[model samples]
Target chain A: MPERAEWIAVDWGTSALRIWAMRGSEVLAETRGSEGMGQLAPEDYEAVLLRHAERYLAGDRVTEVLVCGMAGARTGWREAPYRAVPCTPAGEGAVKVPVRDERLKVRILPGLSQARPVDVMRGEETQIAGFLAGRPRFDGVICLPGTHTKWVQISAGEVVSFRTFMTGELFALLAGQSVLRLSVASDGHDADAFRDAVGDAISRPESLGAALFSLRAGSLLEGLDPVVARARLSGLLIGLELAGARPWWLGAEVVLIGSAAVAEPYREALAAQGLAAELVSGERMALAGLIAAREVMA
Target chain B: MPERAEWIAVDWGTSALRIWAMRGSEVLAETRGSEGMGQLAPEDYEAVLLRHAERYLAGDRVTEVLVCGMAGARTGWREAPYRAVPCTPAGEGAVKVPVRDERLKVRILPGLSQARPVDVMRGEETQIAGFLAGRPRFDGVICLPGTHTKWVQISAGEVVSFRTFMTGELFALLAGQSVLRLSVASDGHDADAFRDAVGDAISRPESLGAALFSLRAGSLLEGLDPVVARARLSGLLIGLELAGARPWWLGAEVVLIGSAAVAEPYREALAAQGLAAELVSGERMALAGLIAAREVMA
Candidate 1:
């Protein structure tokens, strides 16, 4: 007989749902699907989870499922209310979800919220928790780059405060849907172009609106290369975020938690300004976070 | 017998093609169609123009049609090359499109271009010319608000320089398409919310990315009113523009050229910044500019 799973670790986000069949702290099996919390109704969450997890389940005993990310959102399986900041990331505030399947005991971890700047994180709290678990002594900023990049302040193992920027979404919309779409390449990068744009934006962010339109004009007037334009667009947005996020990163020990593809650009931009931030794998952090939450449930 | 038009004035923009059947500056008739330059190819421009102005044409004599805007774009009827700045708005350069129909003589006015910052404008130049025609010695800044807002510096009856902002387009993309769409109302304006947001953005332009995301967070956490959110979105974008365009408007005579619907927000935002700008009808300026161009052709 196949080994029965001891517990499950799930990271459910807007676009995808990933679950790992865990035997204690070790992942025995893993699977993911496009049926994310964004698309699924609250009633559909149980079946979706069971579909990927059924093979690892033992009919004789119930298995505890530790869920993180958007699955705990108000629209997800059950609303795991946010723990307002100046609180520990992914502490003991996991909400017990009433599941139709008797074999599954699911608890979703609560996200962190900041009232002043009015910021909230659905899934990154767990990732932050996971990162903090490994480095409890670390203090300073945690930059989580994604669709909505979050700059979180961490001190004494608690989320002191946080702010979010729509840099990624803005970049996607401008390069894909705006007039610049005609000028920018869908895939490619120019490091020099990116660095130049980052410098320009950091120095004078007020000119961002004019600078963006110039890309379209530049393409028409100067025959600007598509690759360079794409890099410049990414650099400008990221640079603007860096400018906005100066309070979080300046003279502070910064750690970037994201895939290398996203985090690398931020790191390069920061390096230009004399900051060498430590980079960590987002997936690993999220899994570690789920493991931490599970230990508390036990 | 129907009164033949002395000359036809046309403003062929991206979304609409507007024409005036004029007899010596007096509008004999006016009509506009949805066949904007955006949806038409080079060959299709003549047919679309004729479909609207055919009634104004004389059988024996050719009808002179003065065209402005994107119809002069490279992909439009014919390429009316941009005249680099430090020149009069609607002065001499007008490209005559070779059309199949002998009854039509179309001359498209050249747009203005700035070299340093790399900016361009098409239809707005005609309006600028018209506005300048009335005030020959008008020396200051002209603020033209549209999908792409233009802040132009006018000195000694010439357009010294200008800057363009994608503020309007940004507002549309964010309020209509971004995640904020769920929080912001599709149609409505809160004056107080707009003023506050404008102030916030002007003071802290770098915080723009964060400020935008807060609208979504505010909606989630505080049930931020949709109308207020919409107004706040507009205020933030416009405030950012005002912040960027400060060099153009600060300590300069500011005249706004746009329809009341589009220009009102700008005037209000500027008013909050202690500037009373003169608002003029956009259509009037375009017609006046077309008249001025026709005189030059004669």
Candidate 2:
């Protein structure tokens, strides 16, 4: 009477969890919850995961569940140790998360780590692997923009090196918590202002600190628009990231893999810098990456 | 038989209210409270001040209360307004607040504002006035480091020009609230680590966003000491501020006016860059500036 999952794919990050009931690669049903790794204790994770996947599970057979993201972190359900870079994003090393629910068989793919620059990524590696799955010979940089935007360099379908920026987190904190909150709107868009701020930050990267305060100052002295202030704040932070990540994006074929809401700005910013980045769906990549890992197991 | 005051000098900033029971320039009894401008509804300011100054007040005579800082802000008790820059810090404008108690005669000093860069300072102006009052012919840069660190250029007893940085605030947010919180300790100092981070940020300002994330990464990967991480985080933010404020400090006679706890890092960082900064007591400067303001009224 109810739809059953052939298998399951889960993307559990710090603040939220999303699981898809998959018939191989095609989704049969999808659901999400706020029970992310950050809020859950080591033992509390199993109940949350099972609660989300209950409707998709049958009483008789064990459903294979493949996970990516913070669920693989040390503090997650069970630690899936990080795989050193110069390796495939999600090919091997999916640590089985021992669960009491015999109806579910769970495996969390290990995240990637770099020693030199000192960087790590949990969920994005699966997306990177998914992006590379279709293009086995893909050689370029993949930019995944989110709370922690990552710039990953791919060569011969392997992640060579990567770096992460806290631009998104910083923007959230500044806009919501810092003094800039008084000057910025919670919801608004000003494309021209964003472009101008990006250009300003790129040209004078050293003035980042002063430029931030100028938003608040501009509001006080000139009655600067809250919408414009919000847009400029976003641009300045992203621009600083772009400037920091010039080595990864400059003169390289760059693909932006993120949600439209998050990835579009990077596309626009990069375009202004004379680099046209092809934008792709982050959800699709995560699914594809999970499927790729499942196929290997099969 | 109780200790009483001839007048009161109050610095009402955002978080705290510090008042001194003074006989002209000498403090007879000093007391402080948490009733700052940020928390009160403005109309509530008189009661809080009276509460702190009660023991120091006499029923027969009106006690003159001289106040500086955010208490004079637009959202503060009563808008004292701001005097545009290229002017003396605390010479002319002082707004009289209407109070219920005849025992209180309150006057709030106006702050300094810059038109072009669009900056404003309330409490710091008094400190600057104090610094300049003692050195009338001083022509140099005064560095006031705090939550919002200010770089003020002085010439001919006037503010001339100034800029503000959110370096301290940024460090606080990143170290205490952001992802780096897990890696950085709340207390500790590593001079060498601080110096290295300053050099790293100064040498490559563009890598600031990435460099910040590296501290967290370094901890996760190499067990980076939390104390070292804390120092490095402070250094990075301050170094970025220094780089941004280069125009204000380059080849200038720099004197740092702040608490030793707040000013020492800036002094050391400047020394590392071959610029020696003479550190002075912030409390003394503020009191001096308030005294100077009171003297003007006399």
Candidate 3:
């Protein structure tokens, strides 16, 4: 039937491994298995991926396997060369990796790179491609907020450039374990403090270098209620992100892609900046990217 | 002999407490105490200070006491009002806190403050006064680097203005407990990486908003050795401090007052900026400030 299912697209991310079998836009079947890259031992990577693949294959013959996300980097099954900037979905490099058998025909997506001063991203390119695939004519700013919040600019279906801010990580650190933990009262947004911090970040972006001291000073000097100090810290961090990403977003439609857990704050931040943003499901994009990669190879 | 020793000056800080008995610059006697502010309980403050003071007072007619450093703040004996900026050691409005007995004449030094977009300093002022006391004719930049680094500019023995940096705290967090802990290979300086980060900080002080991302990106993408990453983080932090204080330090003689434990790296950082810095002992300053206060009261 259909000359033996041509390919299977796998979106293996930090959290889970998901597979979709499809011919064209129509899906044949979708399955998932527990083989997240984060938990696997470096040596057990192939076994984990293949074992997960077996559950999805269901004894059906599949000719090719396409992998996206952290599965192809140094810690992944194999190292793939990063494609330099000015990259597109169609123009990106693919690494054909040999698993247990040559007949398996596995290809991992390559990441995008920035040369001068050197930076690179592996899993994000696929997400960008998926975004472009769904909205081909979209030309604006796209924000993927996660442990590392990436602000990418897309124009005419190509990633022009991007900058990443450590918003999510800093949030985790400050809220979960850092010195600010003693002060952070709740996870919920403190709207008033957030707005104040955002204004502060934008108005005195340079002061951010000094503004951080406020976290401790607030408590030490003004008797900044510990809870309010927490909120202010959050605001200061997010405000900094807004300030840094402001130049990239000049007069551009803002699009946010990530789990609600990650996207909501970013949306709020963008809204605070007086920018309207369209939310897209990050999981769906991961799937869409896998599908797009399959079609490219086909 | 001066109607018996009237009071004892207790300098209780992070590490140790040194008690001084004086009827002005003429030191009657001094004694070392095992008690430190960090080790004492909130309720035990009076007992603790008295316990140490008792060793030095030794049945002498003690009437009043003057305390500085951690003892004057909340964590210390009592919460004192932070004296706002443009303040001098001799200026009025500095908090004169009363302890246990009114005639005890206990006057804890008032911490400095910055109004409008508030910032404050506690123990650093004493160090500033100590620095000025030692070299009253000296007028320029005086830096007291430690868990909180204070870069202060002085004119005619007055603290014109100053800024506080969390350099020591950041170092402790990053090297001792943060995610970068895994990357910290050497406790000593990595001169090459430190210089690179210093230059990076100076050249793009604004990028500090984004520069932190390099810690993760360096490890993830370019295979940045963790140890180097740790050093780089330290460098970036110190570099940012240098940049933030640059405006205050313009055309000023920089005097670093803190123990070798805290001042060495700051000295290196200053020298990197082509600024000549003279090292002053924080211990000596504390003693000097206590002596100066005793003299003024006399």
Candidate 4:
């Protein structure tokens, strides 16, 4: 192994794979590829990685390769055990596994977990750590919305706890494939209907299970405009999330990490709960997590 | 018009077209076709109805035609007003409209509605009334589980009030077409997983919105077997229904009208709620509805 390596970190997620050769906090070389874990084949995963590495690293000698996120998941290279919650970047340890050849050593970061019912997360832990990297002193709630929406709470830089909501996945199912598909308009926001539905959802949250039926009932009874039903569904789902997460997050400050389109509704939902929040780009957090993982490995 | 003609009733559901020719309470002939309103062009609707009617009648003369279900809605042949709930077999009147030549008089049954917040039912109301037919007096909750499920409170041969659930539609969307489709096993039922999920959904009814996340999370965290997730989803949705309906339905006799396979889970869900329910065939209710609708026109 070389005494020192040129590149510092690599981050892979659901949508894209990104590599950063960092010298401390500064990036020396960066390369991106279309190798999201969802699209990779198990047999050719290593080959795909090598191709991307060759494109970016050329012949540079590297001592270590650290990966965070889905690539370390069961679908990716290897399944890494999850670290239980009430964890922090400083306290959490990286799980190091040797790569295929002796020349390369890879450390697959451990994900976060909750006991009792037993819930866990993989890539998001790194993102949480990355979010903490720049704002290490910050504390309170952090929401990462996507296919599986995460509502995380942090205290003194440690991830105290978190819960997951299937907002995005449900939205996709309802809007793309369900009967409601006939009603969903374009992707643009419908603020009025969104606010109305969010309000209804939060007020009588117990009715949420029954409320879902309204999407069909509304259309059947009153010719519920499909666009409105779409917004109502979005509202009911977010409202349920707020109702579930609110008990744990009454007065905590909220930091939302995701794309603008995804994060905006959540921001509005939180605001409906009378909780104010700040928005942080998910890309930056991934980058931040890559940097943190690198530092820990160093 | 013939001096005395037999009764003809038509059921226009979302998928198929059914016609019944009845003399008093006895059904003389029954025929089905692929002429659902959903598949017909607006201009060709009359032609479709006439063709189907002729095929079913086979030259038999019909005195009065009573059409129920979606065929009467704004999107149907003619817009029929909704009947406010606390409705009775006698109160269930139809809106008279002209079809083709022969001064054809067809009565479109009105849907039932609730004041204030505004909940309503269309075809299910007729089915519920039909289910109540012949019995001297039947009271309690009757559940019509289908693409749009209806939970109706019936008393003294009247539909007092009801709530709708979109269970079947959601199941089709999730298991048949959504991303979750990748996780479902098509061979048969997974009873154990179904029961486990039913327990989870019923125990913490409010957790339904969160519970859906388990489909993706289970796969991510615990190597959630796809088939199990599918069953879990089915259980969770039914569990939510049991939870919501339990408040109004505790101690009330329950009758579920639908296919045995579809209604069995609901029966199990109700049992989980400490409630017992009888399974009634949906086909019987459809036929009963045709008889009742014929009687109304008579």
Candidate 4 local lDDT, B195-248, one digit each (tens)? 888888666765665677657656666677877887788998777666666656
Candidate 3 deviant stretches above 4 angstroms: A1-40, A43-67, A76-81, A89-108, A175-178, A223-231, A264-275, B1-67, B76-81, B84-110, B153-160, B171-185, B188-196, B215-232, B264-274, B294-298
lDDT of 2 at B34: 96
Q: What is the lDDT of residue A259 in candidate 1?
A: 96
Each candidate: chain B TM-score: 0.98, 0.98, 0.83, 0.88
Could you give the CAPRI-style class of model 4?
A: acceptable
Among the numbered candidates, top DockQ falls to: 2
Model 3 chain A: lowest-lDDT 10 consecutive positions: A53-62
Model 3, CA-based lDDT? 0.71
Sort every candidate by TM-score, greatest first: 2, 1, 4, 3
lDDT for position B280 in model 3: 86
For model 1, how does the per-residue alpha-carbon lDDT over B133-198 read when each residue is reduced to its tens digit? 899999999999998999999999999999999988888888888889989998989999999999
Q: Determine the iRMS, in angstroms, of model 3.
A: 2.8
- Worst 10-residue lDDT window for candidate 3 chain B reads B90-99
Candidate 4 per-residue C-alpha lDDT over A1-298 given as tens digits, one digit per residue, 9 for 90 to 100: 2223355467777667887766577766677888888887656656766675644442545546677887777677676677777878432566665456444666777778876344667788888888898888987788888878887878888888777776687778777776667656546567788888888866666566567766666676677777777778898878777776776558888899988888989998888778778999987787788778677666
Error of 3 at A32 (Å): 8.7
- Model 3, span B235-274: residue lDDT tens: 8878877876788666778888989967877778778888
The digit string of per-residue lDDT tens for model 2 on B10-37 reads 9999999889999978889888999888
Give the clash total for candidate 2.
0
CA lDDT of each prediction against the hidden true structure: 0.90, 0.91, 0.71, 0.72
| Candidate with better TM-score, 1 vs 4 | 1
lDDT of 3 by residue, A1-298 (tens): 3223456777776667877775566667677877777676657766775665554443544467788877877777777777777768542578887667444677888877775545567687888888888899998888888877788878888887777776666666656665456556655657787778777866655555467676667666566776666667777777777876778765789899889867876778778888878889887887788777667665
Per-prediction TM-score = 0.97, 0.98, 0.77, 0.82
